[model samples]
Target chain A: MSVLAFIDQSEGQVKKGAYEALSYAVKLASQLGTTAEAVVLGKLTDDIAALGKYGVKKIYHVADEQLNHLDAQVFADVIAQVARAAGAKIIVLSNNSDGKAIAPGLSVKLKAGLVSGAVALPDTGNGFTVKKSVFSGKAFAHVAIKTDIKIIALNPNSFSITEAGGGNAEVSAFAAAVNTPKVKVTAVNKVKGDVPLGEAEVVVSGGRGLKGPENWGMIEELAKLLGAATACSRPVADTHWRPHHEHVGQTGLAIAPNLYIAIGISGAIQHLAGVNRSKTIVVINKDPEAPFFKAADYGIVGDAFEVVPGIIEEVKKLKGVA
Target chain B: MKILVCISKSPDTTAKIAFTDNNTKFATDGVQWIINPYDEWYALVKAIEIKEKDPSAVIHLVTVGGADVEPVIRKALALGGDEAIRINADTPDSYYVACQIAETAKQGSYDLVLAGKETIDHNSASIGGMLAELLELPYVSLATKLELNGNTVLITREIEGGEESCEVNTPVVVSCQKGMAEARIPNMRGIMAARTKPLKVVEPVAADSFTGIVSFELPPAKAGVKLIPADNPAELVRVLHEEAKVI
Candidate 1:
């Protein structure tokens, strides 16, 4: 009846979301009067035992290089085996790209109830009900999972990461049947030296109001000054002013950063759907009537060319950087 | 090659969201429905593009919903699918919907299955994976690009900080998003031809829904925006540091 968390990693490095998932699983396990354990696939730069500080009692390591790359099927197969071996009644994962790939297939394999995008811990008092975001963060739904074994994909940044001081987990090397992946990897194109937009605490985004792609220098400069990631509206990406990966909206990447600053965006419902989950939103636009202002915590009715440079200078001054 | 593209109906992006029946159901009054943008712009259109490259390719659409979703399916047909299958049922959850689609897809024996990364309404992104598992097919999520070469397909999918290109054979499930293909509008001739395209409405297969919605609630409304003077950008910085502490 122990709870198990999948520790997601890429290229031998643990993802930031893993700690939050581990913490969530640990808390849930305590509520169930059981201990929490974690399963990590592939090799890692970080020590597996050190993760116990996040409250995991045990860590299972499958130290195969093939596990370094993500193949959802292979990952699911291994996870299901580990879950059965560990007698895990609940499986927790971060609802990032990797978790999204694995959870559904794992549910099918285990015949367990599955919920993705879970924003809070399950209410286990009566039945296991999880609160999650639906309609692209426009509303919330409390969903009940009825199966004996339940799977939850916790939304990134939704749960707070808690750590215990100087704790050590017992790490065990586990072996499972590693299947040859059907998906053949040809190439990888990683974003260079920018704060990953999904993990960024502060995101500075621009829209068509930036006038042209050439005007984006200031946006990038401001983002660098603030140690933030840069994002764009759909039109900006559609028009090829920015790459599509940076587009944030309903049909684009939905994000929940701590602070999202929008410049020159009119805040269409499509655009707002992706960003409404941000803890704080700041809008800077020339139009006071822009719908984004209504959704924002702070607003500055001004042109980006003038206003953004001023903000950049002020941020620089505040940070004491040249 | 036979390809199965999954389509879903979503409220138009501009529609106002509200709930009815004690917040247990979405209020459908006066909401205009449209094909989910990701499905229309990426999955369905990419399938159409494949057909354009190879005339021998046949594209079939599948959707799980009642008669209200037929128009959205027809729109997909007009965009170039050869036919569409409608599993007539209310979607209780993603698993049940995936099971229904899997039943139909099993009969079709499609070489490839495609769906939007997720529907705008549910935003679950679980259908493709569940459907793949049910049908015993390889599944890929967030495919940004796909190119078919004989029996193998080259796919580029979005990862955390970048994109990875991989190759997979036919009989696979792929959930598509932006960059897979551009959105297409139905031409008059295409719309006229869509009326003759076969629309098969099959009864849903019996499946258990593991999850049920206990209740729905709206997020708390934001306190109105605090407007700062355009000239005082420094005040914005000061307030962020001292008050919000987010900077």
Candidate 2:
């Protein structure tokens, strides 16, 4: 009985959340007195064996090019088969879009009890209970999975990543019958950018206070300097100050990163509902009483035009750039 | 196109969160219940848009809650849903709720299932995924934009670091969030039409529950905001490093 983690990949590269999930699965496996193993569903350019540094002992790779693009039904069926083959009592996945899409189906297929958005390690003294945020991060509930097979989707950045001396994991190819999805892709729309928000450890988000689309360059600059993704408040996107794709809120994207920097945002309750799970928050605004400051771990009361440039400069300095 | 839009009754977004009975359950007293905002803003609006594109399209509002939630169901009907179904039971768990919904969807033979990414009350974003699984349908969550052409549905969803676009066949499940569309209020004509619309209540089929919530509690109160002098931004950084240890 081992812990099985699904390592998500895109375009033959491992996604950042996969690393976080691997780290988390390692801890969960240790607690369960078992080993951690990974299951990859697509062709990957990255060295799968080197993932052993994340503490997984073995990797099961399904290197079919057809599996590259996520087809939830096919992916879930294949993952359920892999979980059964590996004797994974506990299956872990990163609670991002793809995981959310497939987990419930996989759970039902495997008759496994699932806990999504798990924030902490399970309490195993009595029954196997995991804690998860409820009410949009306003509360928490301890859910005890009664099924023999259990599934957990860990929130991004909830667990710290630790690397140690590694074993080059043994990799074996597994083949399963694939189901062709009824949905066929006629065209692909890719948002060209340096980093995707879901993969960024650092994120810089702007709000209405940025004023207009033209001023967005500074936010982007800061994000580029920190190697982070750029995001926006709902109003900013609604007003077309930023693309709708960049919006984040209760009704938008829910992101939890290692460091989240909010600029010119008032921290509306709705907006806070989405990102309060971030490990560390920094707010920059000229308004001293912006609601975002209350939740921010660090605050700078200055105009974005002035403060954001300062931040960009500081990051460059930290990186040993002139 | 047939769209099944799922709505849940949750406390208004600004309500102060509190628990009852030694923190075992959420306190409902004096709390104003509203349509789960995400559903109101995203799912319902998108459904309305689909109906607009095809006047012959049917939109049904579905909920799994006690009878007290009927008014919300009627409100959804007013907001352009052609009919409503209330599964008469408390949504005890994600599994139970998904089973009830999947059973209803199967019987109705709906072409599409729409829901909010998560209910603001429990914040468990599992029902859509669970229902999709139970029905053996494709599922997408946090969809900001959706377009349907022939039998294929194109959806754009928000992910952690970026957005993903996928094309899936009809009979798929989608959970909506902010960018799907702006919420629309019922005009007088729609409001009047809703009173005449049928709202059918049915008993939920029994299903095995694999998990239970032991208790619920509010997050610890945030510490009082610490203020640093506006002129001393450098000192604020110092406090972040030494006091908050967040830098």
Candidate 3:
């Protein structure tokens, strides 16, 4: 039995999280003495065969226009069918919005044990136990799935994507009955920005300590220099200093990125709950006793107005810009 | 327009997490539990808004927890839910919790199911999606705004960079987040009314066999903060580059 990975795509291109999931699945497949395969839903223009560079031996392309937009029920149905057809022992998916919507559905349909927010590869020696973050990254829990079929949704940026040379994979069409979804696409409000948070490896977040809405330009400047997405503390959003959409906390968006830079933010437990999964946290604040420093891998105690522009200048210097 | 809001009892937001019995289990000693703040702020509030819009509409609260969690369930009832259901089991895992909630929702025939994007305890935002799958219903997450037009529900969800709007037919599951609605405290009248509200306790149906937790451990304590004087911002940059290596 081989491992099957669900590759998430949007607007005809595969997302970065998809690559991370692919990388993770390949490692898991190796541990299990099997090859990893990928299943891509919807009509994609991207060369599916190129994905083999990520270690998948085969790519199953279900080029259906009906599968273009995500309907969790329909997606789950298609994935469950693909898993059964491939006789997959383990299924891997990225624990992003789409994966979170579909993986659990597929698990229930397949009666498979599922572990979401998996931070590490499974221990496959005696039993299939996976390590995952619990309590919003405050703790870790190792869970052993005692099922024939298992499903894992890897957190974004949790695994490193490695590329190898010259892998030409076979692409096959997965023929399954497509069900018309009850949900209809109304409108997609795309946030116009330099980077999407889920796809961005680096993220820069600010909090109320930035003081007011006018000072946000520096944070944006730094993020643009780094090609990162921007986020804010809940209080920033609460006070209308920033839009609610930018809030990142236990009650807001949960993001896992390679590098998270939190500026002028006192890391409240709620805020940490949302972003603690980030691979590395760099916190900048003038308050030396801020709770965020307790969770940050790197801490800089300084005022935001002074520190932000300095960092921005350094990033520009690194990029050899005037 | 019957809405069922699912709530989970979690540790207070400020609780200091620790392990017990040689780190094999979560230490619960002297820890105070509260209604998951997110659930209270988003899911329950949105449900109350719907109920207010249509006065005849009923909001039901559902949870999978032990007898001790009834106070929290009552607290939800006090918020505005007309009735409540306690699944009489500690939430063992996401799958188990989702299955039990799905079973109850199926029996109740509720038109809508609302939940917080994720429980503050496990932070596994998998339940609403899993429940929708189990019940063969549409699932929408991180919904900031929701409007119902007949049998169709319009939801706007906050994505990574932007938001997406979708229309789903009835019998759908939606996970609520901030900006959906403002949370309200229980007034004296509401609290008194909650005493007479029907709270049914049901045993969970046997869930599909699954994983068991081997152990739990806290993340390593962060190192002491490095103080860089505010006047010399360049020094902070140097520390980030040479010492911290984050820049």
- Number of the top DockQ candidate: 1
My TM-score estimates for the predictions, one after another, are 0.98, 0.94, 0.95
Q: What local distance difference test score does each model get?
A: 0.91, 0.82, 0.84
Model 3 chain B poorest ten-residue lDDT run? B224-233
- Candidate 1 lDDT at B23 equals 94
Worst 10 residues of 1 chain A by lDDT: A157-166
List model 3 lDDT by residue over B1-247, tens digit each.
8888999998887777788888778788888888987789889988888888889888889999889999998988888888999999877678889989989998889899999888776766888988998888888877889898988899998665677789998889998888889867999999999999999999999986576788887777666555555555566556656775645
lDDT of 2: 0.82
The candidate maximizing lDDT is 1
Candidate 2 chain B lowest-lDDT run of ten: B224-233
**C-alpha lDDT (0 to 100) for residue A302 of candidate 1:** 94
B111 Cα displacement, candidate 3 (Å): 1.0
| Per-residue lDDT of model 1, residues A66-105, tens digit only | 8888888889999999999999999999988889899999
- Residue-wise C-alpha lDDT for candidate 2, range B1-247, written one tens digit per residue: 8899989998887777788888778888888888998888899989999989999899988999998998888878888888999999877678888999998899889889999988886777888888888998888877889999898889887654456777887889998987888867889998899999999999999988888787776666556455554555556545544665544
How large is the interface RMSD of each prediction?
0.9, 2.7, 2.2
Model 1 alpha-carbon drift over 4 Å, by segment: none
Cα lDDT for residue B197, candidate 1: 99
Worst 10 residues of 3 chain A by lDDT: A185-194
